[model samples]
Target: MMGVKQFPEFRSERLLDYLSTAVMVLDDHFRLMYLNPAGEVLLATSASHARGKAIRELIINADMLTEHLSAAMENGYVINQRNCRLELPDLHSLIVNCTHTPITLPGQRNGTMLELRKVEHHLRIAQEEQLITQQEATHALLRGLAHEIKNPLGGLRGAAQLLEQEIADAALKEYTRIIIGEADRLQNLMDRMLGPNDIPNMRGTNIHTILERVRELVRVEADSGLRIHQDYDPSLPELHADPDMLVQAILNIVRNAAQALEGEGEIVLRTRVQRQFNIGNRLHRLVACIQVIDNGPGIDEQLREKIFFPMITTRSDGTGLGLSIAQSLISRHQGLIECSSKPGETVFTILMPLDSKNES
Candidate 1:
């Protein structure tokens, strides 16, 4: 008989390396022994640099995490936490569901295995799907309504024009003129409500070019005190999108930020590239992230939920169609816009896929 074929043993570290959830191993003394790639991403540090560092040094506010790790190691208890907040070194915050498991071998020292799964990512994906669905339904309804309304509107305008030509008295013709003018204004408003109907003229475009166009426009129109700052990733690749549509989308967001700032606060336009990002149901290898951050009074909690819906406005004189139209434009480019606000800061983030392929 032929000799039995032998296969090399699979290493646990190799398995951990492929995991999507962040995994970190610590020695009994709570010193970092190993960090998987996902863990390195979560902590924003490399395994080579982070090895042997104290957990406290890696995470700024790790008191709660420390307590759980200590319990798991000291009592051999497994601990799981949901919606735990982790503050990173760069001041970015993460909400995660984490698990702590104690490990012991026959002759090896005690250790702990920690796993972190980001909660916000999952939540954001759900929200994005819902938003897309809601917008699609709203747009369909509006299209049907527009068809019904526009037919009568055209007839009314035509009737008014005929009356204007037939009227002998100048004063009575003024009524016909008002009727025609008001009909035209309503038609324009309806068109605005419907947003862009033309198919996006897509091509390879630099995101910075679109942002700069928006910046210059806002700067020219804004007050002297309104400052716009740029924090862009210079290495971002060209995106496949419509340059004009992107300009309009970003301009709407920046203009909204300026209006919120009331011409006296700072608005920062920041860009970055995210890898292995999910938008709606598709996963892209690379996605461009654009953020319009403003230091102004935040949006109301109630309004924030419906802020993207048409006709939802916080300002007395505001039309509330700007953001809705912006959302529509970006959606056409396979992107999403999300907003978060507090008392002094509001951020509008737009995520756009860089390529057509959906990577697995």
Candidate 2:
């Protein structure tokens, strides 16, 4: 019989390195012993730098972690937490489900193994998919409705104009004039509802310049009491987009912010580059994150969900088509917009691809 072939001793280290969930090892004293790639990413640090550091120092809320470690060490079993919060070095918090297992070997010091996986990531992805699906359906419905209404509008306006020209009595002519003016207004509204028709004339465009143009336009329209500020990354790369469409999209958001401030608080236009970001269902290597933030009464929770839909508005004078059209324009550039608001702050973020690489 041939000698039994043994694969170079099964290496658990290799398997741990390839796992997507973060895994870490701590010595009996709760000092960091090992960290895989995923662990390093979650902690936002290199494994070499993390080694020998106390677990309490590396992660926030150490009291809970100590309990889990003690349980595993004394019980010689595994302890799993359904949901826990871990504050990473980057100052962001992740809600994770963690597992702690004690490693006890003959004639060797005991150690603990930890596995952490973020729970919010999956929830966020599902929410994004649903929003995208809803937006697409709304766009299709609006296009069909606009087309049906547009033809009748033109005929009504033309007839009113002809009637006004043929009328002799000034009083009677005024009726035709009113009809013509109202028809014209309705036609303009229909055109806006139809949203952008032209394809985005994409090219390498500077994001900051597009923002500056919007800032100037808003500055002209808003009251002098309203202050507009810019926080831009000068080194940001040019994006492939239509400059005109970008202006319209960003202007819509900024204008909304200005209006929310009621003409006094500050409105900030912030731009930054994000790496390994996700937009809708697709993942990109790099993206431009532009934010329109205001220190005003935040958006109402009831209106937040429907804010992007056509004709949804909290203000009586608002037509409510601005944000809907803005979303459509940004979607044309393979991007998406997300909003988060509270009592004193509201932020509308637009994420657009900065490069063609790693598009999923």
Candidate 3:
């Protein structure tokens, strides 16, 4: 304990001034007693602004942090939680891991040491970079496969056409023509599979309009027996995305839900506005959430989580590209797609930042 760092005087205070993890110490009662300099940095508040104030004063939900620490305080205050993101005052987001230890000062009845360490913003940045690399590799492999399959099909289609020309039997000619047509169809499918020019130049547009359009299209194309519900948030803002790509993304998820329903179940398209969502270190201005929920038998246990992966589908006659493409498009927009399913409930949640304002 001799080498351990205890609360020092002037020098310690000076050191706290230069620290950057937004470290804070709470008392046994879960009140904020002290905040170090580094803790101030991540939290965007200085010790003077927060010290001696209840943690709830600066955090919108004081209970969120206190609730976690309460058990530790009661039973010796030893907890280890890491990289947790909490919504702070004024919609600021902070990522911190905390440990609490009961600190009995000279036989004090109740006292504790709460240590919070902030994860560097770069940690999340690194993860995003890794995901982008994976995305690039996926596209490269898809392109290579498309070329491999299309090259041989061209010759097959040519051969069928030549045989058709030489065949004197009407039935044989018709068969050859069918072969060419099918080959061409496959070739076109390959082009789409390769996904050329799928995401166009992005522009700012109202998301409500796109959602309405998608709703109208779903109504027209979906089975008459199936009912589609729409709940739009009037306060939701515009999104910076290619209208075509987003439409395709939403349509794909919704269509999949509808198909899962088989036209008799209910499909709900709900939208809302959210703030202080930290995908990593960035606090979004607003996130436009489009959720596609269906009342069906729910996704299979083996496939529910894996359904977004390429070529993973429960239905026959599906290329298994729709959901994959939808996810890819949404990822490109710096958004995320999450799916969860249980008996009689399946929800696909799409979280896209409105207008790509990710700063702070």
Judging by lDDT against the true structure, name the best candidate.
1
Go through the candidates in order and give each one's C-alpha lDDT.
0.88, 0.86, 0.74
Looking at model 1, residue 359 earns an lDDT score of 22
RMSD, candidate 2, Å: 6.5
Identify the superior model by lDDT, candidate 1 or candidate 3: 1
lDDT for position 214 in model 3: 80
Report the C-alpha lDDT of model 2 over 295-342, residue by residue, as the tens digit. Answer: 999988889999999999888999999999999998888888899999
Q: Residue 253: error of model 2 in Å?
A: 1.0
Q: What residue pairs clash in candidate 1, if any at all?
A: none
Sorting all predicted structures by lDDT, with the top scorer first, yields 1, 2, 3
- The segments of candidate 3 whose C-alpha lies over 4 angstroms from its true place after superposition are 1-96, 100-138, 196-199, 276-286, 355-360
**Which parts of model 2 are misplaced by more than 4 Å?**
1-38, 62-80, 89-92, 99-113, 158-173, 356-360
* Residue pairs in collision within model 3: 19-38, 20-38, 21-38, 22-38, 22-39, 23-39, 72-77
Tens-place lDDT digits, model 1, residues 17-73: 666688988887778989998788788999999999999899888888888988998
Q: Quote each prediction's TM-score.
A: 0.81, 0.81, 0.67
Is candidate 2 or 3 superior in lDDT?
2
lDDT of 3 by residue, 1-360 (tens): 422335565565567544434456676656667776556655668778777777777777667667777777678747887777777887977777777676664457565666666575557546655555665687679879989999999999999988888899997888998999999998988887777455467888777788778878888888888888888888877777888888888988888877888888898888897653444334454678889899988987788656766677778888788877887788778887777899799999888877464331
